[model samples]
Target: MIIGTAGHIDHGKTALVGALTGVDTDRLKEEKARGITIDLGFAYLPTPAGTLGFIDVPGHERLVHTMLAGASGIDFALLVVAADDGVMPQTREHFALLDLLGIRQGLVVLTKADLADEGRRAEVEGQIEALLAGTALEGAAVVPVSVVTGEGIEDLRSRLIAAAQGFSARASEGGFRLAVDRSFTLSGAGTVVTGTVLSGRVRVGDTLKVSPSGLSARVRSIHAQNRKAEEARAGDRCALNLAGEGVTHDAITRGDMVLDPALHAPSERIDASLRVLPGEPKPLGAWFPVRLHHASVEVGARLVPLAGDGVAPGGEGPVQLVLERPIAAASGDRYVIRDTSSQRTVGGGRFLDLRAPARKRRTPERLAQLDALMETDPAASVARLLAIDPWHVDLSAFARDHALGEGAAGRLAAELGLVTFSTPGARIGLSPARWELIRAAILAELTRFHDANPDLPGMGAERLRLALAPRLARPVFTEAVKRLAGEGRLALEGAWVRLAGHEVRLTRQDELLWEMIEPRLGGVERFRPPRVRDLAGLTGVAEPEIRRLMKLLGRMGRVDEVAQDHFFRRATVAQMVAMVRQLAEAAPDRQFAAARFRDRIEQDDHSVGRKVAIQILEFFDRHGVTLRRGDLRRINPHRLDLFGAIGEDAVNSGARSSQAETVSPDEGASRQVL
Candidate 1:
C-alpha cells in the first residue's frame, strides 16, 4: 500500500516517520544540519499492514508544492498535527488539501503530544476533529502519538495496518506510467531514477521511455520498496538504473515521468477541483500565479477558474490551471495548490479533466456548468464530456481527459453507447439517435452537391475534404473521412467523389453543346476534337459555356483529354488506333508516315490529309506505334513511290510521306520526315 504524510514543518513529520519505520527520511544535508525537511524524502515501513511505501515530504511552508506532488498516489495519509502548536497555518492548509484531494482513509497523528499539557492536547484534538469534519477523514481515527516517548506508536502501526487491509491490490496489468519524483547519480552508476509505480508494471531489462521527451532507457535494475526485486508493480516505490543518452539527472527532474511508449503525451490545460485556503484573503482568478503539484509535479501555474467568476477563499470551485510547461498528468490525478509568493499552503484538489480548452468567461451559466462537474457523479461527468460543444474528440484526447489508461475510455464509451468506433478504428459520436442526425446531414450535403452540379458525376475529393475540414480539423478529421469512405457510404471516382448512388446529368445547354461538338470529332477513326476557341467558334457557343460543358463531359469519362488543349471522343481514339495498325501492316513499301498515308488515301481532302495523318500519327506514337529505325520515313517504300517509288519494296519503303499536316507540309515533301 502507498502511504503519504501531511503536516506543518518541524512538527515531527520526519521524526514520526522515522520512529515508525526506523529510517531517517531526511536525506538532504541542509535538512539534517538545519533540523528541517527542505525537500521530498522517501522511506519504507514493512508491517503486518504489508509493506507501506512512505513519501516523506517537506513540511516547510515553502515546500507545500513538493508535498502536493506526493499526495495523490497514497492509499491513506498520516496528518501529523503538532500538539505544541496545534493547527498551524500550514496544518489547516494541508487539511483543506486532503479534503479536496478526496483522501478519505487516514489517521490524524497529533505528534509532539509530550510537548503539550494534557488539557492542551485535548483541546487540539477537539480542534482537529472539527477541522476534519465533513472531509474524507470525518470519521477516521485521530491517534495521538509522541515519537520521543513512543506513545501510541504501536497503536498507530496497528491502525495503519487495519486501514491498509481494507484496500484491494492494484491491477498491474495495463499500460505503465511512472512520475519521477527523485533523480540522483550514484558512484560508479550513471543515473538512477526513482518514483512510485503509478500504473502497469516494469521489470528489470524492460525498455521504458521518459515521457514528455520520449527519451528511451534500459531498465538496468529494479528495486521495489528499497529491496532488489525482479519486477515492480503498481504502488511499488522503485528506483531504476537507466542507460540512455537523452536521459540525465537534470533532464529527468521531478514532474517528468516514464510511461509506456503508447501512453505518453503532453497536456496544456487541466480541469480540476480547486479549493482556496479558508484563511486566504481573496478568490483565485484568471491567470493567477499558484504553485500546482500533481504526479510529482512542483511547478507554477496560471489558474483559470472555470464556470465561476473566481473561487472564494475556502470555497470549492472548478478551474483550469494552465501550466508554464506541458506535463504528463491526466484526469483523476489529485493535486495541491498554493500561493507561491506567500509560501503558504493553500488547498488541493483532483483533476477532473486534462486538456480542457482555454476559453474566456462570457456566460455565467457556462462557467457554472464547469463548477458543477467538480461535484458531479461519474455518469454526469461522462455526460458533460459528451455535451461539450463541438462534441467530436480524438480517442487519445478523451483518454487524457478522463485520466483513464489506454483503451479505458474506449471501453467506457462503448459501455455507455455514447459513441461508435468505426471500422478504421476511429471514434465518432454515434448514439443511435445522434448517428441518425449525422447520417442525414451527410446524405443531405451529398444530395445537394449532386443536384447543383448534375453535369459532373460527383463532388471532387478536394471539395469534400474542404467541406469536412472545418468540422474535423487536422489528424482527427482526416481519420474520420477515411472511416466514412471505408464504410461504403461514399464512392470516390478519381479525384471526384459522391454519395454511393449519385448520378451525373446534363442541362439543356450542355446537351446542345455536346451535339455540336460531336460532329467535329469526324468519325470513330478520327479521335481528336477541335481546340476550345475552334469548337466554340464553330458551334456558335460561348467559350465559357464550352469550358464548363467540357468539364462535365470529361467527368463522365465519355470524352478523353489527350492533350492540354485537345479533347478526344473516346470512341474516335479507339478507331484511330485500329486504322493506324492496319495501315502500318498493309504498306510494306512505304513508311506509314502520317503525311505519306494522307497523300495515298485522299490528298485533296486536306481535312483527311490534315486529320488522319497528323492526329493518328501522334496518337499511335503516344500509344507505342513508332519504329526504331534512325529515321522512320526513310525505311518505307510506299511513301517513296508517291515521290518516286522506283525501287523494290525495301528501297521504296524508305521514302518519306509527302502529304504531311504541317502548316506547309508540301514544302518539305521531297525531303525525309521521321
Candidate 2:
C-alpha cells in the first residue's frame, strides 16, 4: 500500500516520514541544497500488518503535477498541515487533489506542534476540521507532532497500522502495469526502472512492453522496498532490471509504463465520464483544451462533451478526451484534467473507451454504448454489447473495452451463456439469446428457399451467411456457422449449410420425367447426349416443362450441361475427369492436347466429337480444375477433390462410376458447367 504526502512546502513532510520510518526520502542533492522538495521521493515503514510504502510528494504549488503523478497509484492520503501556519493555500489545493484522485482513506497530520501553544494549536485544529468537513477525511484523526520533540509520533504510527489492517487487499487483474516515475542505469545492471505496481504481477524473465512507445523488454531482476524479490505484485513499489533489444537508460524515461503486453495497445482518444470540480470558474465546454494527467503521463487534450452544451461545476456528464499523445490506459483508469492556461486541476475522469472513434461520438446510439461501459457489473456490460450485434462480436475487443481480464470475461460470458467462436486471429462471441434468434432466422430463411426450390439442394454457404448476417465479417460468420454445426443445429453439406433435417424431394411429375431422362444421359452415349429439345420430343413432354425440369436437375447436381442444350449425367462428368487425369499421367510431357482429349471422349461416343470435348475443357478451365497452355491442358491435380475417383463399375457398366461428388454449390454458379 502506498500513502502519498500532500501539503504546503515547509510542512516537515520529509522530516515526518524520516521520523516514522528512519529513512530520508529527500534523495536529490538539488532538493537538499535548495532546502525544498522539488521531486517525488520514497520511503517505507515496516509494521506487524505489512510493509507500507510512502510517497513523499513535493508540496510547492508549482510542483502540483509532480504530486499528481505520484498520487495516481497511492492507496491513502497523508495530508500534512503545519500547526504554525494552519491550513494554507497549497494545503487546501493538495487536499482538493487527493479528493479529486478519489482517495477516501487518510488522516490529517498537523506537524510543528513545538512552535504552537495549546490555544494556537486548538485554533489551527478548528480550521483543519472545518476544511475536512463533508470530505472523505471528515472525522479522521488529526495528530499534532514535532520532529524535534518526537511527541505524538508513536500514536500516529498506531493510527497508520490500524488503517493498514483495514485496507482491503489490492486485486491483480488485467495483468501487470507499473507507472514509471524514475529510470536510471545501475552500476552493473544495464537499466533500472521503478514504480508502484497498480495491478497484476511481474517476475524475472517475464516479457514486458514499454507503453505509449510499444518497445518490448525482459525483466532481469526485481526488488521491492529496497530488497530482492522473486516476484512483485500489485500495491508493491518495485524496481526492475530490464534487458532486451534496444533497451537502456537512454531509451527509458518517466511517464512510460512497464506493462503486460497482452492487455495493452496505446491510443490517443479516451471516452469517459467526468465531473467538473465544484469550485471551477466555469463549465467544461466542448473542445476545451486541458492538460490530462493519468497515471504518470500528461498530455494536451481536447475535451469533447458528449451529452450536453457544457458540464457545470459539480455536474457529471459523458465526454471524450482527444489527446495529443497516446498513453497506456484501459477502462476505469482515473485521471485529472488541468485547465490549459492556469494549469490548475479543473476536473477528474475515469477512462471508459481507450480507443473511441472520432465520428458519431455525439449520437444517441453511441452515447448508449458509452453508457453501458459505465456499468460496474461485468456480466451486464458484456451482455449489453453482445445484444447490440445480431451476429458475432470480437471477444478480445469486448473484454478489453470492459477492462476485464480473460478469466473475468470468461466467467461473465459463462454466466450469460454466450457461445464462443475462435479463429487463428480472433475470439468471437454471440449472446445465447441473440444466437437463438439467428438460428431461428436461418431455419426460417432456408425453409423458404426449400419451399420455392424443392427439387434443388440446400443453399450455398456464402449466400446463406448473407441471408443470416450480411453486415457481419466473414471470419465472424464462419465461426458462428462452425458453432452452429457443432451444436447439431445445422449441417454444412459440401459447400452449403441447411437446417438440421432440411431436404429436397421432387414432385411425381419431375420424378417420372427424371426416370425417363436419367437412362438416356447415363447410357454409353452419355458424354454426347441429345439436346433438351430432342429429349422433350422423345419423352413426350413439352419443351418448356422439360427445360425447367432439366434446370432443376442441374441445380440438384444430378446433371452437367456442357453446351446450350446438351446434357450428361454428373457420373459421366466424373468418369471423364478420371480418364483425362490418367491420360495426362501416362503422357511423357504430363499434358494432353485438347484434340487428343476430345478424340478419346469420341472413342466412347462417336456423337461427342470435338465440339463437346472443347466445351467440357472450357468448363474445367473456368472452374480452376485444369490449366490451359496454348493447345495443351494440365489437370489441376486437386481435381479429384472436386470430382471423386472413378470406380471400376463406372468403367465397366452402362451405369458405372461413384455417385458424382457434389460440386461446391458456389464454385461456378454463374457458369453453365461448360
Q: Against the true structure, whose TM-score is highest? A: 2
lDDT of 2 at 543: 88
- For residues 408-445, could you state the per-residue lDDT of candidate 1 as single tens digits? 54554544554443324344433444444554555567
Model 1's TM-score against the true structure: 0.73
Give lDDT per model, in order.
Answer: 0.67, 0.79
Regions of model 2 farther than 4 Å from truth:
363-365, 383-395, 398-406, 415-418, 423-431, 452-477, 493-496, 504-674
Q: TM-scores across all candidates?
A: 0.73, 0.76
Model 1: lDDT equals 0.67
Query: Candidate 1: which stretches are off by over 4 Å?
Result: 169-174, 359-384, 400-403, 417-426, 448-453, 460-490, 505-529, 533-674
lDDT value, residue 256 of candidate 1: 85
> In model 2, how large is the Cα lDDT of residue 563?
72
